[model samples]
Target: MKKILSFFSYVFHPMFISVYAVLLYFFLTDRYHSYQELFLIMIQIIILTILIPISMFYFLMTLGKANSLMLSEITQRKIPLAINAFLLYILITQSIREEVIPELYFFFFGALASTIITFLLIFVNLKASIHMIGISSITIFIIGFSLHTQVNHIYLVATFLLLTGIVATSRLSMKAHDGKELIAGFLVGVLPQIGLLSFWL
Candidate 1:
């Protein structure tokens, strides 16, 4: 039902996608050799991409800058997207500077690229579906990771792709986006990751 669809949409929110992507990368690559390391990395990523953003959203809502947690209005999206893009950039740069998780540099860069494009498109009067963008970014990153590692992750890739469809449907069912916005979101999420993967690979 509509409630179920709304639940799914909330469950797979774009704000959490960045953290999910990095966690997926770590597990897929078997880079989490120890609990301590994994804990540290997860804490860092969650704080940067998830916790801070949540707090900011609450703050924005208090200030009347954002009308909803969803930021469903086009005008409400610009500042939040800009802030997220900036935070993502900082996350990527700091990871590089610290020489931590070098394998994921391109992945984070792709995420940053996606965020940048999404923010820019807001200026063009396009309110692309961030939901679609979030899912697409991870799906594309998984594909690129499989290729770079010369490992077959077709099942995982397919699973993420399937999730993409579910996410798209959820967004549509919730009346969060039209077809054009959905398509734009998917492309914005995918293309940058592909471009970055090619350069890094």
Candidate 2:
């Protein structure tokens, strides 16, 4: 359960999910859904998803733990933002290839917007809480819907209100987040999802 939860969490991550969405779109519309192609792409997606975040997190950890002036406490804000932006930029650029349709642009844009929103919410609160969790769902719905091509826009949108509530209860039990911070984090998670959905649907 722990591993499953972690995997799900990572899968929903804006950066990772963006990659999945791109790959899904590529395979879905290519008119070439051979098992061979899907297998190849699935490997590519898994590799990129695991590799990118692991690399970035390692760099961040090294810098932060090195106790270097580069990761100085005073400059923590600058570093996280800079690192996040760079990671986001690289991820989106790689995911939305030139060969793909322009609608892919909406997906990337959703990523950007979500990153911005999440950072802002994080600044507002350090901990995740029920409200933050709920906001994330709402955000996811909005982003998904924004894409304008989502197969089940309504279902995705509804997940916000429904899943958010359940997640909120779970968080409460785990004591992972306080109310205010949780709400903020939820919004942060959700806003990008909404942006992404809008890009598609």
Best by lDDT: 1
TM-score of each: 0.92, 0.55
lDDT of 1 by residue, 61-154 (tens): 9999987778899999888888888887888777433266655677778778888888889889998888888889889888887887788999
What overall lDDT goes with each candidate model?
0.82, 0.50
Which candidate should be chosen as best, given TM-score against the real structure? 1
Lowest-sum lDDT 10-residue window in model 1? 95-104
At residue 38, candidate 2 shows an lDDT of 54
Candidate 1, clashing residue pairs?
none
